[model samples]
Target: MTVSVLLFIILAIGAAGYALGVRRARAAAGGDTRKLHSLTGYHGQSVLLFSAVPALVLLGLWLVLQPLYLDHRAGAMIAVADIPEGGSLDLVLADVRRVAEGLDLLVASGGMTEDDLAAMGAADSDLKARLGGVGVALAGEVGEGVFEAARDYRHATHGLSLAMAAATIAAALAGLVFALRRIGTDYRARNVSEGFVLLLFIASSLVAVLTTVGIVASLLIESIHFFRLYPARDFLFSLTWNPQFRGGSDLGIWPLLWGTLYVSFVALLFAVPVGLLSAIYLSEYASRRLRALAKPAIEVLAGIPTIVYGLFALVTVGPFLRDWFAQPLGLGSGSSSVMTAGLVMGIMLIPFVSSLSDDIINAVPQSLRDGSYGLGATQSETVRQVILPAALPGIVGAVLLAASRAIGETMIVVMGAGAAAKLDLNPFEAMTTITVKIVSQLTGDTEFASPETLVAFALGMALFVFTLGLNIVALYVVRKYREQYE
Candidate 1:
């Protein structure tokens, strides 16, 4: 049976266990719930949790580990002589899996019987034509070693799946019996159930922490490999960015860093003032009707995808700037430039800054504003001195968050700002950021052993560090400001 079907059956069994557990608990209590240590529902829930949770955990582990085990077993069957020139073990294993899947499909489709499969030998049979007839296309005819391994893979996977099903069902049944036996009048079912739930919550929280650690560890390991193959100093300080898979490549960080900062700076220059001012007006002066209409309209900008904004930069904003501004001012006339991306990114970021700042500004105490007004300050003065001062930390935090968003932006940089890594002062010149290069370096059939491919990991680590620093600063500022007001 399929995993989904097995899961459904397990859940049904758990539901039945819950009913039985409730009946058992009432029987033990002489049908008087008042005599029990916990509520009737708790007894039922405890049984349900025991019957389902452990079995589901087993199922999840099996699903994750089964493929790795199959790959290891089947992969070992192929000899060194079976691997073609320039081919890796991973690629050969992929072929084996594909062939195994095709053979399964052939059997399911009634094109091949178990007897036919048993009688066929890889060295003397036309397996390719049979697979092709079933619409399972292979790059080439399967070799003897691969065909044998594919058969072994199919058998192993089928056996493992059956074992997993049997084990999970057995676990569910065992848990059901154990839980039912414990459903007595004096059993502390509520405490046990709540404690189990608390453990689950703790596990859920740890999942996020573990995910972050995994990301950092993977990047650090790959980056170490990259630095071993290529000089760390050249990667950190070199001005040029070029990657040649064959050999001698100048891998640099300066040009990409400069372009990233330049574009983000321009975006902030445009977004911060406009977003902050819009927030000020909406919070301090605008009527309720206007605020309601204007806030959602402004926030709609954030809902639009970044790629759409990139297209606007490419097709509309880029050309307009190149023709009317760049060419007339004697700057470069490229359609894709730093200005195009920055302007579009700024527009995209407006909602982030405006929405967050607006909320923070509105959160300022009304008492502060009233006190300022009673001290003979004008409305504008009251807002500036009382409300804004109270809200300053949050606004600053919002701007920094928006800045981080701009720095990490990729689609706008790719479409509006062309992929030319350089450190030119002219905003009209095309440039690229670290993210674009990370993608370019990792693209195509490049091997991970080379610096060109592994450099993507280094670029990723750099971006992570930069963004992490910004977040730290934002958090510190927010905390300091928040403490004073609170």
Candidate 2:
């Protein structure tokens, strides 16, 4: 049976068990609620939890591990000679899975039978054409070993699926029987049910921690693979960024790193003062009506998609800057330049800084402003001295958060700044960032084992580390200054 059908059956059984447990508890208590250790509802909940939770856990484990076991067995069946040149075992395994699925579809459609599939030979039959008729396309002709492996894979999968369903249902029934027998007047059903709930809450909290660990682990492993193929010093300190798929390549990171920091610095240089001043005006000086109208208007910039921002950078901002500033100053001739991307990215970052700063400024205690006013300080003086210092930590955090956002931006950099990686001092010269290079390196037909493809992971790891450093600095600044204010 299918997993969904089995889940439905298990839930139905749990429902029946709940009703039976409640009835049994009332009978044991002589239909007197005062005699029971816990409420009748707790007894029912206990029965439901026992009947469903174990079975669901088992089903989840089976679903996760079954495919891994099947894949290993199928991979073992394919000989090394069967894997084509310029291909790995993973590619062959993909073909085996596709062919196996196609065979199942053919059998279901009455185009083939189990006996026919068993008797089929790759030497005599056009396997690709037969599978294609059933809507499964292969990259190349299937070998005899792959065909046999696929057949065995399908059979093993079918057998395991049946076994999983039976075992899950049996577990549900066992739990139901055990809980029903334990449903007495003296049973501590409430404690047991609440324990399960506590465990569930703990598991939910660990999910975020586990997810972060998984991301770091994956990036670290792939980066290690990349570093083994290429020198770490060259990847880190070399002055150029170029990748050759054939043999020799110059995969330096400095040009990309310089472009990323230069763009982000330009963006922050524009965004911080404007956004912070806007926040100050809205929070401390503007009337309530103006605050309501202006805050949402500013925040609307954040809602527009990044791709839309990229297009705006491409069509409007890039050309306007080229014609008005870059050409007039003779800094550069190109429409796509670092200044173009930085200005457009600064526009995009305005909402992030303004909204966050406004909220943080407003969060400051009113008493500080009142005291400053009582000391005969003007509103502007009070803001500059007392309010600004108090909100400095949060403002720093907001700026760094915006910086992280700017560093990770790809579409704007690609559209506004051209994808030329170089270490130049001119903001008007087109350059690329680490994110752009990561995408370029991974695009098109490339081998995962090659340095070009693997470098994407290394770049990603570097970005992650840089962003993590920003967050750590933000945290330290907040913690160190926040105590004095509090």
Candidate 3:
């Protein structure tokens, strides 16, 4: 049966069971109203929650794995001979891919004519269509082998969906049966039901734990490979960074780290002041109309794709800085120096800072603003003395978030920042970043088992650790500030 139909059956039973529980609880409590641990409503809530949570978790996990499983199984179904040769292999494969895409869209879009969907989903009603009506056409043209493979793929998809749907419905039904069996004189239905409500509370904690664990695991595995190629001391503290596999040489991380840090720092220098000022203007100074119009306009900066930013750096900003500030007063560095990337990165981070800081500024209590006004404080003094302090912790958190974003950002730095490995402070000279190196190492015709390719994972590990530390610190600071307010 389809998942929706099965779930509806389970839900029907659970609702009936919950109603029985509430009735039983009310009867037990009577008019004295002290017999049960909680009210009748709690009994109903518990039954509903107990019936749903486990089933929903199962459903969600299944959905996440479904695409991967389907793709792997489908691809494997096309053997070397069954797919034909040369150009025909390409054509048949393309046809199969199109059919798969159509099936996915059919499932997603949720409407179909019988003619479009007929043979494939006669395999199962769950599959609404196959692309180009090709599934049926394949039976003759490609012979028995290709036809058999197509049939197998269709069967596997149906089985997976059915299995997932069946499992979810079974859980929900089991919960309902348990609730019904317990519907007796003096059963603790209310307490049992409220325990189900606790599932939502548990979900938030699980998400945080899972995210931390997953990031740590990825970094740990990669770092292990990286340490294998380069010695611990040199990798961590060497003053030069050069990576090579073809000519044989030394690879030190210091130069890359230096470049990465310098560019990020420069980006932060520009982003913070502009972002903070923009937030203040929007939150305190602008009229509602002005805020409404301008907020989206500025946020448009963030929505502009990162590749577009990269192209803009390459075509415009990199050369502009080279000509304008870098070469002008002699304090200027080279055109594609630290200054170019830092400036562009700062522009990229402005939306992040402004949106976050604006929210923080708005969060300052109205009572504080009123108190300052009552004391006849001027607009500037009220905002300066009363408002900004209250919002300082959050604003600082926002800046750190922007900083972390700058560190992890790839395209602008890759395009604007030059690939030099110098440890100097001159903004005119070009510099490289950790991410750029990660990309370079991972790309080209390298074997997956080689040290050169494996080093990418190590660099990835370092990046993860760096960003994770910043995020944790920011989260802690923001939480402390919130608790004080509460």
RMSD of each: 1.6, 1.6, 8.6
lDDT of 3 by residue, 421-449 (tens): 77988886788888888888888866555
- For model 1 the TM-score comes to 0.96
- 1-486 per-residue lDDT for model 1 (tens digits): 899999998999899988988888899999898999998889999999999999999999999999999999988898887788877788788889888998899899998898888777776566887877777676555888888999999998999999999999999998999999898988999998999999999999999999999999999999999999999999999999888899999999999999999999999999999999999999999999999999999999999998999999999999999999999999987899999999999999999899999999999878788888888999989877788878888898889889989988999999999999988999999999998888888889888688999999999999899889888988888787764544
Q: Give me candidate 2's TM-score against the actual structure.
A: 0.96
Backbone N/Cα/C clashes per model? 0, 0, 5
TM-score of each: 0.96, 0.96, 0.63
Task: Score each candidate by Cα lDDT.
Answer: 0.91, 0.92, 0.74
Q: Which one wins by TM-score: 2 or 3? A: 2
TM-score of candidate 3 on Cα atoms, chains taken together: 0.63
Tens digits of per-residue lDDT, candidate 2, 1-486, equal 788899999999899989988888899899897799999988999999999999999999999999999999999999988999878899999999998999999899999888888888777566788888888987677998998999999999999999999999999999999999998878999999999999999999999999999999999999999999999999998998889899889998889989999999989989999899999999999999999999999999999998998999899988998899989999988999999899999999999899999999999999999999999999999999999889989899889889999999999999999899999989999998999999998888888799989999999999899889889988898888774555
